[model samples]
Target: MREDFLLLNPGPVPLAREVRTAMSEPMVSHRSAEFESVYERAQNSLDYIFERSSLDGTKTTSGGTSLVFNGTATMAMEAAVANLAGEGDEVVTVVNGKFGRRFKRIADRYANVTPVEFDWGHPVEPEAVAEAVSDDTKVVTMVHNETSTGLLNPVAEVGEIAEEHDAYFVVDGVTSLGGDEFLVDEWNVDVAVTDAQKCLAAPPGTSAMYATPRAQEAFDGEKAPFYEDLDWHLRKAESHQTPFTSAVPLFRGLAVAVENIEEEGMQERISRHRSQSRAFRAAFMAMGLSMFPEKNDESEYSNTLTAISLPAGVRENPDAFFDAVTDRSVSISGGQAHLGGEIFRVSNMGNLSSEQILRGVRAIGEAFHEAGEDVDLEAGMAAAREQLR
Candidate 1:
């Protein structure tokens, strides 16, 4: 890889120098006082992010405990489900993208799942979600930002429906928590999970979740997997520790990453992400590319990433186009699952600057040209510049 190689994938974003340096610090025993201090720092910084993660300055959470997992967000997702619901319980999972479906699959292992399904790339309807949830529903799960389709779901609206039924609301805020607005208390989210990668801009391996008192009261350790029992995790968290061994280096990196978020301020970070996303969208539109997802009144495009439909010329030979991009020392992702080769995705997550985003736009435009497409590179650049300004 080139020294100047750029990573524009949605998760595992390019880390800042300070975060990388923190991970390289001398290893310490997971149970040692030194490690516990690291854990405490990470947890405290995380609490700051969780409590202040609002897009419009209208919502913030308080009094919730943030817990870390040695595994990724998927583990946290499973823990949220397993600890709350069990065999005869009904879990209402709102599915509009891959992550939402994953939540349903996890819920299936422990409870009877009621899936409120929608077409991929389409907005999830809160009314439909309300129809699915009832007083008997033990829990309701939703993905805040569907990374697969670049659509931000109506989490607050869906959360309201779950609240009406008095169901435990679990949200996978994997891509939205740190980059966009997430109102845990105002949205009535009982538990919310996020990965160290994604919006946190740290290395992979570790994840975190926040649990409210209501959710804590409902936790059943005996019903959960031994390693995922929230009751045990919470008990251990009082000492700033996990139930088992922890990822020391990843936790160190996460501590610094959240510290970076604190220094930059949540409002400014969210503004940067939103601005960069708009720039990418404007650039793609100017080059005659359309976004892959459609939005309703309750939904909007994701602020962390942009997914564009592949032009006929590029879609016919997607590999060559992506190869061209790779040759430029920049990396972006293609659509996953059935949408593969149909769309391409780029992320503005983490601490990306305007220049890097502009370069990514130019690379995509050049790739289109290589694929025999008549995209206006200058026009795309101009549009991106306008948005950045």
Candidate 2:
């Protein structure tokens, strides 16, 4: 990382050098025995990481499985929808943020998609989800942490509904897994999807989705469009392989990454993310910053990323603030598309230390000053430190 570039973005935040080095090894053939062994390790590692039945999800290590879909978090998503839902099958998708909306668009190509959209910063109601699950509801999807608006949806409740109705519960844990509290088996999720770039502390190309037995059962007989074919992937996945090749380096890198989490413990990592996130929020509140999500309790507050309403005038010219922070070597981002110019999303995914918190607050306070808003950097930083401590 350059002294001028500090990655505070929600995705692709910052990766440890060890994982990156593993990804930088010599390339090998997908069909090679060495590759199969490498593939098996990754599948096993991901199964544990995603909490896959203590022995589930795709155990495949072949082609690009390690990388989160060709450098974007979207591919893993496409894979999940295509592999799980079939043509004309109605899927109820929650659209509370950009990510959820993106899922809707992706589903439109393969299934009969029914979108349950809510206010930009609003949380999806469990009751609403229950009501939305019509008889034809074969699949239900939502982003646990809607990175677009930084809202967390109710996965547990949604999962329960899926259990009651026998529908597949597909959760986009892209911004939550590895950094937030998620239970694959206990939650009863059919297809739990996530990208390594977000909170897994891996590079952008690696993402994963854990399939419960029910999800696997649903995959059979339902032939999806080619490329997103779940059947083909599963056949290969069953043998700890893939239908196509994967980025070998991320496969290796992700294994090390998952090993790190295993050694440190998943709950411990969740606590770290929660603590840092709580501190970040408290500090923002003390500085008179307003949280967009409104409620942080059971609503959609995420520990990995939090969205805030940009202060007045700053939204008019976000660059002044963005540039000021960039000058300080901290990188934050605005929302996506329609919501972009109004909200600012701050992430503590990777490489965010308690020391970095001080620097981030200082940069934000200084930016407000540059934008002609009086601010107390010390007070914000102090509150943040206290929250962490």
Candidate 3:
């Protein structure tokens, strides 16, 4: 297949040349000494990203051991819960969007679930979480960034609430860990999951999770489903290995991606993502497109993706809205679940530059016009330029 369109979807984002080259190298043996070096390097990167100095499993709250699963972020999310929340234990889930709802679904299968749901496009309030947790609540699961609605939840505030209640906090940080600012230890995140495809700027084959020592207490001799078990993963990860045969190529790609992230510096990478998101938001607002989320302030906005409603005429024909934009060689995303066809999501993650964002805004403007919506392309571009500057 020939690649042509500019991929602006959240995960499986456009990869860096170095990461691609690393993946393109010859196949490697997962058991070889060479692979062990690669595995350690990746673990070191994960450590830095999780804000831990080591993974020696010494500290109760900050023992930063990360497990890389040979599956998608969904698998890691399940592991984080399955390993902690067992039968008879109550689990609290914050459902503000699709991904948050997924935590409730997964938790339902393993334990008693108490869902604290919010409006689809609104952020989860800390007070609501405080009200949900109790003595029987074993886990409190939340999404750091609700990718479905482009709403950033109050992770820190909720983390503190969980701590006060002595409930384990499991966070789905897939879209925020690398692109946005996150501190597993500082935020009291007991278990957090992230993917290689989203902000990590790599292909999707493996996902990683950070588990603190206190979280390890959830193990009750009974384990989760075979492949998703964190006990088996931690046992193998001690030797810089996985329980099953791993995808060596994706590991190589991820290692390089982590190196590139280190070179760019975490703060610089976060600032870049923020700038890109600001530019995209400014352009959309200038073109008279309101965000799907009704935000009173910027605190609830996601820096990785923006969910914007289509213009009046364009909303009448959702397919035409998508087709017109794809016809211009730009690949953004439509909303998911109940939000389907109502809003479009634009991701500013991975290796995207200012020029690509400008082009994307232009393509969207063209698509709006093509769909018979009267849009001010010049005004949108000007607003974007101001933010980018």
Best by TM-score: 1
Across 1-389, the per-residue lDDT of candidate 3 in tens digits comes to 23657889988798888888988888889999888788888888877776621223222234668777788899999988888878888999999999999999999999999999988887787888889888777889999999999999898898888888889999999998778788676678998899999998878998988888888666542558887777778888999998889899999889888777767767777888899999999998999889987677986899999999876677679999899999988989998987888899999988788999999999999999888888888899999999888
Model 1, 1-389: lDDT tens digits are 56689999988799998899999999899999999999999988899888898776554978889999999999999999999999999999999989999999999999999999998888888989989999999999999999999999888898999988899999999999888888888899999999999999999999999998899999998989989989999999999988899989999999999989988888898999889999999999899888897444323999999999998878889999999999888999999899999999999999999999999999999988988889999999999999999
Error of 3 at 159 (Å): 1.0
Model 1 RMSD in Å is 1.3
| Candidate 2 structure quality by residue, lDDT tens digits, 234-324 | 7776566667776777777776777666666666677777778877787787788888767847335778777778888787788888888
Rank the models by lDDT, top first.
Answer: 1, 3, 2
Model 1 misplacement above 4 A:
56-59, 296-299
* Candidate 2 lowest-lDDT run of ten: 59-68
Which scores better on TM-score, 2 or 3?
3
lDDT of 2 at 191: 73
Q: Give the top-scoring candidate (lDDT).
A: 1
By TM-score, the candidates rank as 1, 3, 2
Q: lDDT of model 1 at residue 169?
A: 97
Q: What would the TM-score be for candidate 3 when compared with the true structure?
A: 0.95
Provide backbone clash counts, one per model. Answer: 0, 10, 0
Question: How well does each candidate superpose onto the true structure, as a TM-score?
Answer: 0.98, 0.90, 0.95
Q: For each candidate in the order shown, give its overall lDDT on alpha carbons.
A: 0.92, 0.73, 0.85
Error of 3 at 88 (Å): 0.7
